[model samples]
Target chain A: MSVSSQDIPTAAISRLVIYLRILEALEAAEISRTSSSDLAERAQVTAFQVRKDLAYFGRFGTRGMGYTVPLLKRELMRVLGLNRTWNVVIMGMGRLGQAVANYPGASDYQFGYVGLFDIDPELVGREIRGLKVQHADELKGFVQTRPVDLGFLAVPPEHAQAAAQTLVSAGIRGILNFAPTMIQPRLIPGSSEVESEWKAVSVENVDFLAGMKRLAFYTLNPHLRPSELKPSELSSTELEA
Target chain B: MSVSSQDIPTAAISRLVIYLRILEALEAAEISRTSSSDLAERAQVTAFQVRKDLAYFGRFGTRGMGYTVPLLKRELMRVLGLNRTWNVVIMGMGRLGQAVANYPGASDYQFGYVGLFDIDPELVGREIRGLKVQHADELKGFVQTRPVDLGFLAVPPEHAQAAAQTLVSAGIRGILNFAPTMIQPRLIPGSSEVESEWKAVSVENVDFLAGMKRLAFYTLNPHLRPSELKPSELSSTELEA
Candidate 1:
C-alpha cells in the first residue's frame, strides 16, 4: 500500500512523531500498555486531541484498554518512515553544520551524515569525526550519484537561498535549513500546484531573539514582568475555541 | 514600576519576540501601518490571537485602523527587553557550543557571546572566532564578575544538568540548553522563589526525533500517503455548534 501525501495533517504527523518518542521512552522503562490520557500527559497534549489525531491515521486503540504501548509505537514508527535510514548531507562545514553533524540527536534518529560540503579550501580536506569534508562544487554530482534524501543548510544567511536552490536542483526532496533567511523559492515550471509546501526549516532565531526581546520588554515596562508575558491557560482555551 | 512574574505566558513571551522580528523586517521594508490580520498572515497565526496577545501587554492597536507597525514594533522591542545588550556564555566548547557561539542569529539579536567554557584542557586554552575558551572551573567567578543573564549549554547530555546548576548557582537567570538530556535540578533551599525561578529550558530534540518518526511512519505504512494529510477546514456548522 503506497501512501500519498494527503492522508494526514502535517501537525498530526509531527504529533505522531512525539507519540513515538514517548512510546519509546515507555518501552525503555519496561512499560507496555498506555491509555490515551497517559500518552497525552506524557506528550503534553489533550487525550481528545490524541484520539482524534490517531483516528485520522487509523484505528489503533481498544475502547477499554486504550493502546498497547509497543504496538502503537511500532505503528507510529511505520507511519513516520523511520524504519529506514535517511542519508543526510551537510552543506557548509561551518560551526552550525559541524554541530548538526555531531549532534547525538541526529544519530539517535538514524540520520546518517554521510558527507560534508564546503567552499573553504582549508576545511575541504579536513575530516570531522571521520566524515571527510568535500568541496561545495561537488554537491550536484554528489546528490545525483549518492541520492541523498535530506540536506541540512548551515551556511551564512546570505548564502542560504543559493544553497537551498542547489539542493532543490540536485533532486533533494527534504531540507532542514538552519540559515536565518526567508526562502520563498518558486517551483519549477510545469509542476503541479501543491499548496505551498513549506519545508521544515527549524529556525533557531526565535528563542534567541525572543529571549532578548523578553528581557528588553521587561526592562522598559518595569511593571510588565516575564511571567505575565506567557500565554495563560484561559488564552489557550480561547484560541482553541 | 516593578513587574511581577504572573502576568504573561512564556509561550506568548516567545511570540512577542517573533512579533518583534517581523516588525523589524516591516520597518526595514518601510511599511508603516499593519492590521492584526496582516501581522497574523505574515506570522502564520490568527488575527484574534494576535490581538489577544498584544492586549495582554498593552493596547497598541486601534479599532478599524489596525496597529501602527512602527509604534507596535517599538513597544514590542521595549517590552521584550531587547533595548539592553545581553552577555552570554556558552558552556561545553564542543562542536555544538562552537556552533552556537558563532550563530549569526544570536549576534543579530544583540546576544554577545562573551566566553566559552569547557573542562577539556586542550579546548580551554583555545580561541574560536575571537571568543576565548575559558576553563569551566572559572564559570562561577566569571558569572559573578560579568553578571551574565543567559547561559547556552551545548555540552553532552550527561553534563547538561551540572553545567546548568553551575550557571544557576552563579546567579544567571535565563538558560538556553541544547543538550538532549532532561535537566531537572533540585532548587536550592532558602532561595527566593522568584529569583531562583525555574529556568526556561527549551528542548531542541523535538524536530529531529519527530521528523524522523514521521518519515519512518510514512515509509512503513505505504497506504498512508503524504497528499492525504491536509487538515480539514472547520465548517461554519462546526463553528456554530
Candidate 2:
C-alpha cells in the first residue's frame, strides 16, 4: 500500500532526533519515564507538539504516565531506520571529508564507515583511518561489493554534482551533501530504446554558511526574541538561532 | 520598547538567505523580478509561506505583481545583518577549523577572518589563510583589540565549553558552535563572590551528525516524504528532506 499522504514531515524527523538524544540522556541519568512536558522543555517545542510528532509514528505515552524512556528510545530508533547498522562512505578525502570520516561518534550511533573515495590521483588507493581511498571510477565496483547506505559528499562545489552522480549511478541513495550547492533529483528521459529509471534519492544539505548567517541575524537583532518566530506552533525560548 | 513579540523567526532568516541566493542567480541571468510562487518553488515552500516570511520583514511585492529582484535581495541582506562586515574568529585550528578559516565564500558574504585561536602550542602563532592563530589565552586580549562580531567555535567536544567561555568572557555575543556537545551559557563566580556577571549570549549549534541522521532516515523511509514535514506550515509537495 502507498503511504504518500501519511508520510512524516522532515521537521518532525529533526525533532525526533532531538527527542532521541534527550531520551538517551535521561536514560543515562537513570530516569525511567518522561512526560511530554519534559521532552517539550528540552526540545523547545510544546507538550502538544511532542504528542503529535510521536503520534505520527504510532501510539505512544500513557494517559497519565507519559512515555517509558527506553521504550520510546527504541521506538524512535526503529522509526528512524536506526535499528540496523548502516555502512557509510565519504567522498572527497579533503580535510573536511577526512574529519567527517574519522568522527568518533559515528560508531556510537551505528553509522559505520566502510569506504573512502576521492577523484584525485594521489589520494586514490591511500589508506585513511584503516579504510582504503579508492579511485572514483571504482565507486560502482565498491558499492557492488559492499552495501553502502549513505554517501557523505564533501567535494568542492564545482565537483559536487558529478560526485553525487557517481554515488547515484553506483546505486547509493542517501546523500549528506556539504558542497554548498543545490542538487535537484529528476529522472533522465531516455531514447525510445532505453528505459528511464526513477531517480529516487534523499539529499540532506548541511549549509554551514546559512547557519552562520542565522546566528548573525539573531544576535544583531536582540529585540527579536526566540519565542516570537511564527504564528503557528508552540513558542520556544531556546538559546539557539 | 519591546520588539520581542515581533521578532522575525530564525527559519525566516534561513529562507531569506535562500531567496538572496536564488535572486542573485536570477539577476545574473538578467531576470529582474519574480513572483512569490517562483521563489517558493525554488525554496521548496508554498507561495503563501513565501509571502508570510517576507512579510515578517517588510512590504516588498507590488500590488497584483511580483517583487523587484535587486530590491528584495538588498532588503533581505540588510535584514540578515549582511550589509556590514562581520569579524569572525575560528577557534581550534584542526582540519575543520582550517577549512572554515580558509573558506573562499567568507569574503563574498562580508564575513572576514579576523583571528584564529587554539589551546595547542603547536597551533598557536601559526598563520593560516593570512590570519595568525593565537593562543587561546590571548582570546580576551584579541577581542579587546578587534570588534569580533561572530565567534565560530570548532574546538573538540571536551574543550568546547571552555572555548565558549573564553569567547563570552572576551565579550563576544554571537557564537556559531560546531562542537557536537552542548555549550550552556551562565555566569562564573569567583571564590569570594555571591554571584558573577550574567553571561548573556546567543548560541547557534551546528550539529552535523543530526543532518546525517536525517539523510539516512529519509532515504530509508522514502514514504515519509519531505513536504510532509511541518504541521503548522503549508504542506510542501517538493522532493527534499
The deviation in Å at residue B138 for candidate 1 is: 2.1
Writing each residue's lDDT as its tens digit, candidate 2 over B195-240 gives: 1221346778877878877877788776565532222222222221
Docking quality band of candidate 1, CAPRI definitions: acceptable
Residue-level lDDT tens digits of model 1 in A1-241: 2345455655576677668777776677667778777776555567887898787767788787677778988777655666568898888888888877777876765788877998989889899979889998888888877758777788887888777767666666566666665443321222333223333222212133343455445434433433321212211211110
Candidate 1, overall lDDT? 0.64
Residue A162 CA displacement from its true place in model 1, Å: 1.1
lDDT by residue (tens digit), candidate 2, A22-131: 78766876777788887886676778889888888777777777778899898888877777888988999987787777655667779888999998988888898898
What TM-score does model 1 achieve against the real structure?
0.77
Worst 10-residue lDDT window, candidate 1 chain B = B232-241
User: How much is A234 displaced in model 1, in angstroms?
Assistant: 25
Q: Candidate 1's residue-wise lDDT over B158-181, tens digit each?
A: 778778777766666666667765
Q: Which candidate is the best by TM-score?
A: 2
DockQ of 1: 0.31
Q: Cα lDDT for residue B217, model 1?
A: 51
